[model samples]
Target: MNTFHLGLIINPLAGLGGTAALKGSDGVAQEALALGAEPRAAERTRIALECLRPVAERVTFLTFPGPMGADLLAQLGFAHQVLGSLENGATCADDTRQAMRLLQEIGCALILFAGGDGTARDICAAAREGQPVLGIPAGVKIHSGVYAISPRAAGELTRRLVEGGLVRLASGEVRDLDEAALRQGKVSARWYGELTVPEEGGFMQHVKQAGMESEELVLVDLADWLRDSWEEGVRYVFGPGSTLHGLAANLSLHTTLLGVDVIENGQVIAHDVTERELFNLVDGYPARLLVTAIGGQGHIIGRGNQQISPRVLRAIGLEHLRVVASKRKLGTLEGRPLLVDSGDPLLDDTFPDAVRVWAGYREELLYPVGWGS
Candidate 1:
């Protein structure tokens, strides 16, 4: 097997400097508490590091000093080769370039960083023809194809690559989006060229649910089943996706097509509920979570709704919850697996040994819950 050196960088404020939207967390420091927004980046880096722990034995991890990447790795009891020179206050963006240059000089096979779209551009600045990199989706607005579906997905993909999982490497595009236009509630997409993205399994594109015309009828039938099978006296916390939104359309109610919804037996109790609100809804009404994997990415939880905290998941229990995906959607997953963020990290730790994800009514597929080994 060929071993690769993966350099880890955390652009502490890359996404924060963008527009005042919630997707950009770096600028959040100026808007909120003086905690410097370190916790967000720190926690994400920690999550990324935690996922990489089991794979530690498979690859060489090259890293920078404190706050850059080293501190988080050390805290997790992970050993890595420190790449560049380390010094004071860990001046944010300055160190990102320095760390990237050092990784290139050291001949690292790939670089994995965590941040938003700006961080992706930063990598694009120094990325070469054959250099491969991956991003742990931590930034507020990660409208880029360079990112792994989720933090754990990033780790799983890295693990698969190290295990000689026949993977293809290709040049993936890096997009340049207009932050101001997006802030003005407009969509303006521009090309920013391509970077070498290691072609591997499980990495997905967020698209308008694919294979639409063919699966339209099945989707329609699935929607009817969901609305009809809804339990009485129990609340339904529907995560974002067209499939979940289908139930709302059938119920003669409006829902957030791209957000979480809390519904009662027949009415829309609340729309665009957050992770916190979802938990409260479940507690107050005794409910189950109904979610579907993102069309391209095999993620059922932890994509857009950070409001569904871990505390709520434990209260509702995954045993009572249901995961729905169209047959076409399941095919794209390619056995990559499903993920749940559940605000609290520990909940994903204790999920069921296996879950029969509902691909459609009378259609189910069995997949494991926990497997870091």
Candidate 2:
């Protein structure tokens, strides 16, 4: 029984921009921190490690020093070796690159890094074709296909890899968006490179697509149904996306293109609300959450609208949840089920076997929802 050597890297600042609604943590990490952004990468990485705990004895971890990777592994009591050195405080791109070089040199079987697009770019720069890698999605803008859908999924994939299961390696895209342009309410994304990703049936994520133009008629039909079905006194919480934005347009209400909004009595009470703000607004009211899936990925909760959150979802109850997707968008999934990675395993399990996706006017499709690995 050969022990699998898994390289681990943690970009401690990956998801700091999410709660702050900074769109992404690249370039504006300092600003996000000043706005009281808390470190989330370590906790997300811990979640992945927790899922891998059952197979702990079959693996030996190789990681960087301190907050980069070693601290979390130490806390989790995993057998690990800290391979490189870094400053005591903030870790940079250079640190990640150096760590990757060292990990590859030491012959790690597979490298598991935790971060967003920037971290993915750094790892790609330092790694070669034959070296397999996977991402633990702990960042704000995760448009890359190299990541597992969630941390728990990452753990499960890693477990399969280490146990010599029939997981196959495939070329996965690395995409980074312009955070500056995103903050200005503009989307600019580009391809950085590709990496070798371990693929299982429904475990890996698909790269995000910018826009889908063919869904216009579908949007109008869905909007018409929503307009007729509007209820009084029940707060309607709209998650981020153009589909929901279309519904807002049809209802003659204003909504942010990429931010959460709350509507009550057919009026926008809260525009561009945060997770905490959303929770506050829906505290005692009967609330219904209206969300749309990612155009190509079919992720309803975890990808962009972390503001909905697992706690918020539990409060809204599964019955109060409404999902909308265009027929064109659903077609992109190719029989794969809709995904939910709310960062809370228990809450994820509470979702019903299948939810109804409003595809058109008075049209609904029962789609299976996938969680866990």
Tens digits of per-residue lDDT for model 1 on 1-373? 1234578888765545334444455435455334334346667666666666666765667887776778877877766777666566544555676777778776565688888776787777776655667887777677778887777777776665554332335566777567666656777876676776654533222223442434556556666677667779888787887777775676677999888888787788899977677777777557877777776566666777566666777778766667766555665756455565555556665564334455444444444332221
Please tell me which predicted candidate would have the highest lDDT against the true structure.
Answer: 2
In candidate 2, stretches whose alpha carbon ends up further than 4 angstroms from where it belongs are 201-373
lDDT of candidate 1? 0.65
TM-score of candidate 2 against the unseen true structure: 0.54
- Model 1 alpha-carbon drift over 4 Å, by segment: 1-3, 14-29, 32-38, 85-87, 184-186, 202-373
Residue 285, model 1, lDDT: 59
- The candidate that wins on TM-score is 2
Candidate 2, position 269, lDDT: 96
